[model samples]
Target: MRHDHHGRTHRLELDDQSLRTWDSTVLASDPEDGLVLDRSAFYPGGGGQPPDQGVLLWGGVQTRIVGVRPRDDLWLVPDPDDPLPPVGTQVRGAVDDDRRSLLMRTHSGLHVLRGVMARDFGVPVTGGNMEPGQARLDFDLAEVPAGFKESLTEKLNAEVAADRAIQVRVLPRAQAYALGPIVKTATDLLPPDLEDIRLVDVVGLDLQADGGTHVASTKQIGRIEVAKVENKGRGFRRIRLKLVD
Candidate 1:
């Protein structure tokens, strides 16, 4: 399977992160199996980001998509009370701009955090999770410098103000792995047989193998506030961040 195709559904979001709405044909629709589309921009959740939520409009009715089940086929889970578009039905798919845009900014902001931490503290991210406007990353830091939280907040905002460009690219497996040690995770989780790899680059900051949507630049992330830093023991420190207006 190609990296851009999820099962039979052509994943439009992979190439166009800014695309919010598009026309598609319903390929399969089952009450229990969920719906599949010939083309979709709804991002299937992966790499610490959640799947997108939106609606499919057809025949003057709206079928609300609540979640996604990524499998052999990208199954779009719709709201139980909504009507389903039958196979071969033409429909208009729309991703919730507010939710997806915020997610893009938040995901990019986390990369900024990763960049700053790696550049300054030289630590690898152990784990992380994110929502629309908030995120937290765990790092394997043996010691926290004095005023570490304040220092990190300042550095994070500085990078945001820098407006560093974010670029996405797809490369052959060997070429991607050749950029040794790009995966920021404490453990490399990429599948062995995957022929193509998708990479997200916070230009001049951080680059990693990722499969999530992101903003065009760091400035699009807005102000990042380091809300808290908690010591999780065993040389693990959790840093929480919030995006402010």
Candidate 2:
């Protein structure tokens, strides 16, 4: 299967073996970076997060990998007409760290708020967006009171101030099943066979089967402010939030 880490770490550096794995493509000789790996950790714009872009280096040539997508396997596509490096060639792969860090922090921040909403308001999330510096999530709630939004804002800020640690781990499918029905019913994802399940836990705040990168701790999320709430009818409310300086 695909060796993925998009839901695990924010920034990762390549080592000897991993680097070799990335430079094995020989199909695009006249290519840009000419680097291609059997599997990649880059998130290809799924579940509301956008695709990642960065540069790959080969023989002093810096080629831009504009987009990453899953084909029969995950193919690292460089600019148009770019050739692939000869198979057995070694190249370096790098992700745009600044943009990746933003996604990681913002995505974790949204989850922090999500867990808080579930605990305090008994509202379940209907949908959400994990964007850079901006995020929004919808919940199934009766009616929105004027003070509710402000109250939530204060609560989420406190959670961030708590500085809780965030942890991610891989779990066997059966081992994960032992955690109980609460989580099993929440996600439709299954570990390939029984060894590919990955679990993301926010210490005491939240736990779920997720495949996205996140901040190491809640404190890194900074100040979360509830910007607005939209009533979408049928006890559905959407909350908009932003990071405060």
Candidate 3:
């Protein structure tokens, strides 16, 4: 969502099994400006999921990619004082694997909670975001009584225990719009010129149009600890959760 969809590279997360490292070539580079690659594995920040960081190795040297911005094009910005790979240079990009794994689990945990809320309580998730190991989701329901969150937490862990497989696919815009995903925030924001939609399905559980990276299964999300519940007013409520052990 940060850059024009066309300017972004083929998302590495879509491959499901290809998140470890990426090999690419420098498409554009400026010592005082930033770097652009022919293709990149970094997930440009969007959908409440922060961008990924790692190192780019070239000519026996490593440049830490501190962050990325989508000004005009997807720019792979390196940390100041770090060497920048020049245009036409061959580079190997490595994402912070541990951080990425934790984020994937946290993101998937939020999706699981959303699915259970809809399936059992008929409540829809409104919005939320995630940090490294924790996440939160908002719901349209209000004035929930005693033991409501306790029961919800129980159901959330049940999904993880089930170890259901996670599936990802790119559907045509028309067909994707027809599924009526439980969450529509991301899909609804896609630029009109976007031809295909990315869908993440938690097997027999939940499905939504999501652009963020996620684990391959519910079991990979680990156990979720309900940290707090809040009344956001106007019939909005929030559940904060974290991945544990």
Candidate 4:
């Protein structure tokens, strides 16, 4: 199976992160299992990023997609009150641009934070979570290094101001791992059976095997404010950040 495909659905988002709308055919639709499309741009939630919400239009009607079930077949969860397009129906699918765009920026901003942490602090991320405009990443560090929050905030915005380019690529599993500890986390979450690895690189800064949407450049991430830094005990520190306009 190709990395760009999830079961029977040819995942359009993986190839074109900027794609907001497309046309596709309904391959399966059920009240219980939800709808499956021949081609879909709806990004199923993964890597701390939530799934996309959108709508499918057909014959003067619309079925709002609220969530996604990433099973053997990608199942698009529809609004319970909305109507589902029957199989074989041609539908126009549209992703919520505002939500997805914010997510891309927020996800990219976190990468900049990760890069700064690894470069300056020499710590590994233990866990993290994100929403549209805000995110938090936990790192394995014993000392706070005095004025850590203020210092980190300055470094993060500097990278954003520098406008570093962000690139995405797919490489064979062995070739990806050969780059020397690509995973920045304390725990390795990558699947062992995967043959192809998708990588996101913040050029000249950080690179890791990731399956998430991101902006084209650090400049697009805008201003990153280190909101808070907490001591989670046992040498774990949680850093919360927000994107400022």
lDDT of each: 0.95, 0.66, 0.80, 0.95
For model 3, how does the per-residue alpha-carbon lDDT over 114-207 read when each residue is reduced to its tens digit? 8887787677777888888998888888678799878878889999999999888878888987887635432356678867778889988888
Write one digit per residue (lDDT tens) for candidate 1, span 1-245. Answer: 88999999999999999999999999999999899998999999998999999999999999999999999999999999999989999999999999999999999999999999999889999999999999999999999989998998999999999999999999999999898767999998899988999999999999999999999999999999999999999899999999987
The digit string of per-residue lDDT tens for model 2 on 1-245 reads: 42343222212321111121133232333354333464344556655566667766777676677776544434566777554456655666677777777777777788887788767776677777866778888888887777988898889888889999988876667876577432412245444564556666778887766666777889988888889999888888888988875
Which parts of model 2 have CA positions greater than 4 angstroms off?
2-35, 81-86, 181-195
Per-residue lDDT of candidate 4, residues 11-105 (tens digit)? 99999999999999999999999999999999999989999999999999999999999999999999999998999999999999999999999
lDDT of 4: 0.95
Worst 10-residue lDDT window for candidate 2 reads: 12-21
Instruction: Enumerate clash totals for all models, in the order shown.
Output: 0, 11, 0, 0
Candidate 1 pairs with clashing backbones: none
Better of 1 and 2 by TM-score: 1
State residue 42's C-alpha deviation in candidate 4, in Å.
0.7
Give every collision pair in model 4: none
Preferred candidate (lDDT higher): 1 or 2? 1
Model 1: how far residue 35 lies from native, Å: 0.3
Those runs of model 4 whose alpha carbons end farther than 4 Å from true positions after fitting are: none
